[model samples]
Target: MSFPDNTVLQSFPATLNHRNATIFTANRTDSSAQQAIEDLIDARLQLRDRVSAPLKGMENDLFAKSQPLDSLRPKLRVTFGRAKRDGAFDWPVEEVINTLGAQKRGAPVAGLYGFGYRKSALGLIQEFFIFTEMLDGHLNGLTWLKRERNIQNLIHVSFNLLHALHSKDIVHMDFWANNVMIDPQQPTRAKAIDLENCFLTPTDHLTEVLAFQFGFYYRREIFRFVIEHDYDRLVFEELGKYDGIDRRRFDEIYALSKHENISRRARREIFHKGTVVTG
Candidate 1:
């Protein structure tokens, strides 16, 4: 049996419920059997749910605005449902490309598209880009994680996974909370998504402006999403945990996060460090 490479597959539709939801077409697929299970874990963590998780009357209000997908140069169709059956494949194509190293058409996918773990794991959510505007107060996680420390696990997993990839020389151009997903119940291990704009540095060390930009954005998102999201929780969670627990955890998160210190400092070394700041 030979699965031909570079074969452009046509996507069909699967049933989904958009009622009282935000701007999105409800479809699922069957070919994404592997992703179904992976997405299930991600859905469990509620990363995408938090991002795309429609607001109260989000559907009613969404149509009022417009987006890139509204006119829709090229739209991706879903082909599976979460509740369809015991087994199904109905996740986004970006997810497919991440874990499966495949594509439906000539459309681009994230750099981590083909990067994934051995078994089922989460992937980034790309569906949010097709919008006129993002909803307000995605910072709602503050309220959700209020007075709880477990949420740190989610933050930890989301941030660290990207750092781990960066350590491997993968520069994730788009490093945002929305682009990462957490594995259900396992906050230590998460998945990175949206490689369409990501680039893997051929050389171990990348010394370009793009690397700096990627690092800067990655740093911003990690600080904003990971540390800020549940810093207090993590702090207390590590209370009496160990002598160097915090440092160890910090290193772990840094290793897994997509923000690379190398990428961040590489360009600066060439441009500003040596350049004299004349008064």
Candidate 2:
């Protein structure tokens, strides 16, 4: 799926209508997929009541959203609903590309189309929607890495993507292989998706304040790799070579698991220095 060479929209419209629901797009100048977006919304509303688990619901919703529509562009993807505990609907791809200046950094995120929301009879927000360019012939990183002939290239690109994000002070809390997309045709090409959990911070560590505030679990290995600015451990992990990890670093981060009340500043200091630090 290819898009014509047109200037990407820099701002979202105040509002647009699609039946009872309102619509928004990443590019206001691009007038397409309005009916498809509304159809996605309708399908999601119908499935919302039947699904219970958040992740499971999203899996089902992806299928629902993929229903073919004549107006839907072949390159477009419409995602509905927010992750559990998300306070508001945020267009992370728009923020990363537009606000953070990641467009030039080779930050592998899908091109945003826009988002929309529907309000209930009482004027309360009911459903949320997101639209982005589809990554055709791409598989999740986990599955792709297993069969990829040149695994090194994918691993290297993954590290580069992470470095680009970290340079902008953005920590992608869910940097797991499942969140990465790899194109088989272009083996080295990788893209990061599922950006709702990402956050910007100056420190290299996942501080206690930020973790609890965002309901993020303290992932020691992720924190270790982020602080060290290295991807060797991740390469091993992704390749299913758990025994290949650096035991010293693993044990060091593991030691902090039992200390629940450590202060945010202390946790940050501990991560940087690899030593117990008290606030």
Candidate 3:
């Protein structure tokens, strides 16, 4: 029931997942490796203070009520602990709820019920977990687009969400299809999740985590599909309307984004920061 004393946890991979805590399962046959992994995980968890004091304080309160072993969820395979400096514990339940409310003006978002953290010998750890209503029959944007043909509504919904974030002085630095959930029940509407990287009028340095080129490339591809497939004018108009940029001007801006002479940083700033480029 307990990990061996010597497990060495692995660092997180660049590949994306909803949770920040990366779990490494112990191998009963290879006790040495499992122990090493567990030890590393323990060490990593104990050294971090990334979350706000209020959140950490709240988590400490929660931890006070439960045993560390009691915090483990078989489903998640994550050993819940105090918020870490790795930004895992930053999305406390209150923040998620507030963000959901803020996002109501744009697209639908999953509901967060509550959160909890755990304490260790090193004190409060930096990892935490949340409870949410399952986004039933939902898939990430990347997978959904590959299978679904009715792309217009999803695209519109994404723009709406982005515009809504912009209106609130928020920019979702991690605005990729993978982060956007497309629910089968709400085919036309997409829900934006993973707001951990979202920032309110974030400075360029703060938003360095965002992969602007990937998102811009995705949008450009979507734009091309709209044009090549001869999607209804209404769709184009709707995109322009929701995005707060003229529909007629999309091609021009997209062109500028792809220009070889333009610096990558400049292109990213133009595309993601909404810098208007006049002819």
Global lDDT scores for all candidate models = 0.33, 0.44, 0.43
- Per-residue lDDT of candidate 2, residues 22-139 (tens digit): 6555444223344445555666655554221112223322211121212222112222323213232233322333322333445666555454555556443454455555666677
Candidates' TM-scores? 0.33, 0.54, 0.44
Clashing pairs in 2: 26-113, 26-114
Best by lDDT: 2
- lDDT string, candidate 1, 104-148, tens digits: 221122221111111112222223212111222222223334424
Whole-model alpha-carbon lDDT for candidate 2: 0.44
Q: What ranking of all candidate models by TM-score puts the best one first?
A: 2, 3, 1
User: Any idea what lDDT model 1 has?
Assistant: 0.33
- What local lDDT score does residue 123 receive in model 3, on the 0 to 100 scale? 39
Worst 10 residues of 3 by lDDT: 4-13
Which wins on TM-score, candidate 2 or candidate 3?
2
Provide the global lDDT of candidate 3 against the true structure.
Answer: 0.43
